[model samples]
Structure formats: C-alpha cells, structure tokens
Target: MNTQIKGRTISLRLVRKEDAKFIYSLRNNKEYNQHLSQASGTVKDQELWINEYKNRENKGAEYYFIIERLDNEKRIGTLRLYDFIGNKESFCWGSWILNQDKTRSSAIESAMLVYEFAFKELHFASCHFDVRKKNINVIKFHKKFGAEITNETNLDLFFQLTKTSYGDFFTRNNKFIEN
Candidate 1:
C-alpha cells in the first residue's frame, strides 16, 4: 500500500520483507513476548509469513505496520490492524511492541498514530484489541484510551473504542498530546 503515518514521536509504515529479521527478533524477545503471541522458528519463518500476508487479496484485512523513531528512522517495533468485525467497519488492533528506550509517551504517540490511521484514514467505525490476561501494562494502557473491556476468554481480554468515544477522548486529552 506504500502508506506511512507520520506522528510527532514515531511513524508507521507497511511491513516489508526487509523487516523480517527485526520482526522475528522482536516477536521472540522474552521481555516483550510474555503476553504476546510467540513467533517461533527462524527469520525464514517470518519471511514466509510476510510473503503470505502480502498476498492477501484485501490489504485492508490486515495492515502490518513497522513503528519507527521519527528522529533517526530506527525501526523499533510493529502494530497490526486485523480481524475486521462488523463487515470491515471495525478492526482489531494488535502486534504492538516498542523499544525499552521508548517511554510511555512514545507508546501513546504510536497509538495515536494507529488510531488516526484506523478512524481517520480507513474510516473504520471502531478499533479494538485482545490483550493477554497477564499483560497488565497493556490492559491499563488500553483503558487510558477509554477502551472498554468488552469480551473475555480464558487467555485474553478484548477492548474496543468506538469512533465517537475516540473522538471524545482526544478532545479531552488534547492537552496531554500537545506537549
């Protein structure tokens, strides 16, 4: 799709084959993988997955984005939007991980970029995520965006943000984002 979302602290670009190794390492990293779905095997495995993903007929079905530092353009992590619900009117957001050096503000900035892409660019009615039950950090993070816990399985907790709720959130929190 050759798309990029530029944010104040980071930007998101479509995943490319060149990012296979970086993604593989990030997916397997212990520090970040506890609640994350593990990506085992090798970088070649990731390459194969990427190849298959790129071949999907509907690119909107899955948007895999590499998150990079705006300052030096260093690829730090990734965020993916998928599992479209309500006839692609809404989607599930996941596959997010940021470098340890990136602070909470950086995470928020990256999320702001993702929400902007989902709600503004894609015009999706809602965006949500399934967070692993044990990932308290991320669960709390999602709550800050006013994402309500909607459903739960033994392993995961799902949260969603409606377009209206999201807009209202930004209106209330513009001060925090300004500086």
Candidate 2:
C-alpha cells in the first residue's frame, strides 16, 4: 500500500515519530479539540505513542496520517484509519483535526483522500465512523458526502458510507479529487 496519498492540492503521509510535536499541538488546540477525545501528556509521550503505533502500522492493523500542503509541504492536519471490522469489509476512521487558519479546502480534500485510500488502496467496502453529537458542521459534512446515519447515542452519531455511496459522491465532487 502507498505510504503517501496525494490529492489536487494536499497529500497525506504516514505519521512518523518526528511529527510528535505537531500532533501534540493540534490535539491540544482549543479550536479543534472540542469534538475530539482529550489528549494529554508531553511531546515525549506522543513520540512514545507513535513508536508503538508504528508497530501496528507495520502489521497492517492501523494507519495515522499527517496532512500537508503539496505546494509548501507544510503539515496542516492529522487523521487516522483504524478499527477494521467485518474482515476488512469496513473500517473506522477518526482523529480528524485540521488547522483553522488554513484554507477550508483542506477539510474536503483530506476526507476525499481518506476515502480514496480506504476504498481504492485498502479495498474496504465501506467506511464507518462516529461524530460527536455537538459537532454539527461535521455531521453536515458527512451527510453531504452521502453517509447515512445508522445509529445515535447520547454522545455520538454513527454513520456509514458504502463504496457505492462514495462513488456517487465522487461523481458530484470530482473537482476536488480530479486532476
């Protein structure tokens, strides 16, 4: 599988131990951390965590990505793909956090890239994830991408997007992913 997935304006590369500082900053950024699980500890802790994560990555159990702008090659965001289910028929992805100061396109492009990697590269039939109930904007974003809400709880809403649904979304949003 490819280590880096490039899009029209941005690319996603596997997270390395060296990215601990950046990841730590993003995890603690008030603007982006509201909807995410609380992250604590120093950059050293993050580095240690990444060291362990690398082993899972090697075993094909999970993937964490650092999103960067292709023009300047600056790291701008982070996302992860994990929680494989149904014998590779579906996968769960979360930990999506992006810099607020950057262009909004980063959000769209990063998501497009994730779906591309999951479906095209990993051959997963569908993507399933949960969004915090209070994260309305993200809920809308997934709905617009044709993800169906399958369940909801006190804290989160679960959604699913099949490959067919993504194919349809791709047809409509081709500009974001096309050359």
Best-fitting candidate, scored by lDDT = 2
Best by TM-score: 2
**Model 1: how far residue 136 lies from native, Å:** 1.0
Task: Report the error of model 1 at residue 123, Å.
Answer: 0.8
lDDT of 2 by residue, 111-165 (tens): 9999988998889999999999999999999999999999999999999999999
Worst ten-residue run, lDDT, model 1? Answer: 170-179
Error of 1 at 57 (Å): 7.3
Checking candidate 2 for backbone clashes, the offending pairs are none
Q: Which lDDT tens digits does candidate 1 get at residues 27-61?
A: 88888888877677999989999999987625567
Off-target runs (Cα >4 Å) in candidate 1 are 101-104, 175-179
